[model samples]
Target: MSTQPTTDVAPSPPAPSEGGRPSDGLQAGLKNRHLSMIAIGGVIGAGLFVGSGSGIAAAGPAILLSYALVGALVVCVMRMLGEMAAAYPSSGSFSAYADRALGRWAGFSIGWLYWFFWVVVLAVEATAGAKILEGWIPAVPQWGWALIVMLVLTATNLASVASYGEFEFWFAGIKVVAIAAFVVIGLLAVFGVLPGAHSDTAGVANLTAHGGFMPHGPGSVLTGILMVVFSFMGSEIVTLAAGESENPQRAVSKATNSVIWRIAVFYLGSIFIVVSLLPWNSPSIVDDGSYVAALNTIGIPHAGEVMNVIVLTAVLSCLNSGLYTASRMAFSLGERGDAPKAFARTSARGVPRAAILSSVLFGFIAVFFNYKWPDTVFAFLLNSSGAVALFVWLVIAFAQLRMRAMILRDDPSKLVVRMWLFPYLTWATIGMISFVLVYMLTDPDGRQQVILSLLAAAVVVGIALVRDRLRASRPATASAGGVRDSAEGEESLPTGS
Candidate 1:
């Protein structure tokens, strides 16, 4: 029996443009290889490099279980997202899907919130990358390095989508190679097979010999979830970037299918080597990062500097993608009449120049806030955007549930990608995400982030509701005129009446 809905609407809504909205000027400049590397490399984050230490400390070797849990959540979410994305590829990605499946309010709220999240990330990654670069060259100030890095990536985005893709390809490629090599070499040392290995403590027995796996207690596994969940933020970026590829559906399908292995190899595989190579409770794991400590255990030369280089690459890759993702979301919102129309316009090379500039403008302001008011204003920005990744996954799951029916009824052939277990897994993903958000309230930092993020979301949702109400009250002629002349650029509203 087919699980798909049988009821059909005659003459369904038109399919959205693929590989960029040609009607409004987003272009198909990304090649297959660009998308391939983005998907492969996107799974590994700078957080995995810098943030995993505390998780290991808290959960002991059971931190691996924490990572595994989050990885499974992301896998389920990606499968749902891929189902919709493969059916109707859009530059707007999940936001667009929300517009179609849920409502304009959903699309508008999530889109702007997503944009806000990445712009904040811009400041975080810029500061991180700048700190590294300044250490390498003491002559250049940290702020100057931040400015230089932002300007370089901004120009790359404004040049063309292809330029962004090419840069990301190499950046992601480096990360992929770095992690793969780390895993293989660390594994070699773990089993005492490496010829030059120095540390006698390197062995698989380290997983249990230190404190019996869950040293602190099983409760710490949930704590580790809070520590590691955000690292998976970039995993969905390839779905958004796919809209600019030569084959959006094909690109999305391929990326979605490969996600499991990518997470398994880059995240779980490397962390396995880390824990197996050294005890999770080792002071070195907490003092230095997990990866750096493991490398040092085996007497790898200058392990600190080597990890620094890799961390810097991850930061740069994140900053580069942050700009691209934020601008593209802005471009998408503009096209749907939710934002200023100038963001919808594109350059001759098919770059959304105004959108790029606007996103970077906010990012620059964020960078300023980071340096000028690190505690109050910058902390607010960071906390407010912290829980947005969870919000995004929730929205994607809901949208997929609604969108699956629409696609099946309208044109089942467009279902190139399908979610496993139909509505069952989809509901399970939603339940897990909700539990995570609620569980966050029990922790101090996580509680602050959730409260601030909710406040931010409420404000956006309020604005959207007011706009919807105002549009509803206006006469048809006036509504049309308002779309044309209003400063908000609410033209050609895509949300169905």
Candidate 2:
């Protein structure tokens, strides 16, 4: 989410501002169009294209229930965030809310942990995108393609928010249209309306035919939950993007309010058509990946190549958003004095050049890891960042609980995107996330990953606590004296100051 100024509070220290260098003298260069597309694109991700296969395998046709359950949780979480974001609207989004509602420690922990998660994800997506490109051009090598993709995206992000948004808008538009077309064709095939279609394998019976709806039993549904939850991770990017928006409050409200229908159509709707067009137990699903296999079963020509192109687009889109999110989160941290002030500086177009460069550097390092020590480096990166989704979601829930009370006390009328059932539903969502985390611990496949992720969270939280202690122990003289003013004086102010 984009960052907003603190409301009705004394101005805090100004970290380096974006939009231009300290001497270049420019203002925040983000525009409304950039914000809107970022918000929309945030909700669609590569996971939807790639991860649904694992989910379907785990829960069979009943995977619909898993999506519905997770979708409901996301809607509730986003609504809670929307209410707080509309009132406060900072680029830090939930992290800032955590600071105000919970404590400085909560904000520091969540913000840094989230930033870490996305940077790692940037490497993952770049690798995935590179693998796809390598398939088309065998001579380039996967690691080389990974490096090239990261550099190109980093350049786009460093250019301007508008440039990044424009790129993402087209990327997201392609994925959205592709999914819609898939649903349409699948529905036609299910109803036996496609010209000369001879397959007898289409209809609702596909949901229950092979060993009934819960083929793997109720236990597997929990497994399905694990696969589905990650798909929802990108949806929260809207709140962060909203912070930079011209009308942050409105942007948050619209994005949060619209998320439900988007989930319904893009997620539930697409999966429904897939299952309806082919039996849940069909060999094609596990053999060819879910969506591609479904299309191929219906005799769609070039199904493999077609799906590969769509998946490639989805991967590239994810890589683009990952870079943008990592930079913005770093920028937010710098603004709050939680990170180096250099990260707070922006380019001529309001791009946080330092932060963007920092994230890209990590992405480059990851490409090296992919080439030199794929087993250890990539595995560690994956395991360490596994639980971030739960951590972030929990922060959102806690932030909303306090933000709701603050809104009620100050200006209840501003609660335009309130979560349903308020505190009750909020608590329930927390419980649900907690349950998922616990389930992850018990599942053998997820246990080590969860443990590693928890360790990463612990490390960040420890750093935050140490930082807070150091800040508290400092002599009041340093804070009250001219130390701050001297620092400010050494740096040239942005233009328009």
Candidate 3:
């Protein structure tokens, strides 16, 4: 008789589990519906809306290659993450996995780096959304709109996990619908089938019309990669959200199975339509957005405003998810002794109140610095965070190497989502990410982002080394009286080294 695999995991921790503190103290309030939508929505970020414009202009039709390349890279990383997460579900996600596979220091550095990344993202998304609102309403100053937007989302997150899930579900839905409609309508325009679509300029010819598909040559496609890759940043949020889902394995598996195609269609497919509908050199593309310009070509009323509203929704979705993710990671870190115990505490609604508030507080402070010195303070923060997503992915790739072997040594059945080509593809992904980081160093702007991020990572790593030393000397004090090895419950050797 054939046997089917099963998955029922007990969470993993950086240190031993303590007596009273829960790994997350999070409720299973996130429904399957919410999980699916969050997965779908998280893939579509505001970066695609605003940043894709720059990608198209730079790489022209060849930008599709950039998107596809990065999309494939994301697929490999996410699949590896899904594998570990399914076996050992944790709110900390990759950071927790890094701790188990690498070391406490590795986990500590990445956890804090990731939390820092999202907190910074919260500020960026809030600022972007505020600018759009302030444009619409003359009464509110930009800072006022920023404050209002951040507070509203913060309240939604603080209310309950379900409230955050519901808000993200709707926010992602709008982006999904908007992109789907844009693809359908834009494709028709390309083929000269849709009414009001200018077929004369919109067709396959547009691909070669300006300077040909490889207009800026192969090099631009690589540079386009730097631009296109960051848009895929939020895709990892799915596995993080899975910890709170009713069925974590199922949720992570589903998200892993489908994220690739979703990104391919939304990012690559959408860009294809834009390039097809108009020349890459079109002046209007940059100012109005490639999508907005395409809509204008078809004579849609208030096309720019319509796209702006959609962008705003994408921004809000990002802000909502960013806050939730950062807090959850902080919650996990606290539970593992990598953060303060207070952060591990949760309210009745299963919300990490201290973690959430701290994350939001940093976000608010970032927004303030953004206004005071947009060029200096906020720019440094942005650059420092620029490469963290890649760094996290790199850690995931390496963690999966050890994780996969360990899972096999323990029980392979729990790996519901397997990374393709195992060691080879895993090595290849690691190499590819390293290459991107190095490639960025060649450009002045990209170099700043990379250097700043590395400096930030180095600082975190130094802190982690000190913390690990302190923990080793006084484990009891570190975990607040003591921590029990859950390996007794997990029926395995201790995950910690």
TM-score of 1: 0.93
TM-score of each: 0.93, 0.90, 0.92
Of the pair 2 and 3, which is ahead by TM-score?
3
Candidate 2: residue 359 lDDT (0-100): 81
Worst 10 residues of 2 by lDDT: 486-495
Q: Which residue runs of candidate 3 sit more than 4 Å off their true CA positions?
A: 1-23, 475-497
Q: What is the alpha-carbon lDDT of model 1 when measured against the actual structure?
A: 0.85
- Runs in model 1 deviating more than 4 A are 1-23, 477-497
Query: Model 3 over residues 1-497: C-alpha lDDT tens digits?
Result: 01111321223343312221124456677888899999898889898988888888888899989999999999899899988887766788888788878987888799999999999998898989999999999799999999999999989999889999999989999999999999998888888899765547888798987888989999998999998888888889988888777777788889999987898789888999999888998988898888888888877789988999999999999999999999998887776667877787777667778899999999999999899988999999999999999999999999999998887776666667898988999999999999999999998889999999999999999998886676567634232224334211111222322
Q: Which 10-residue span in candidate 1 carries the lowest summed lDDT? A: 1-10
User: Which candidate has the highest lDDT of all?
Assistant: 1
Clashing pairs in 3: none
Ranked by lDDT, top first: 1, 3, 2
Better of 2 and 3 by lDDT: 3
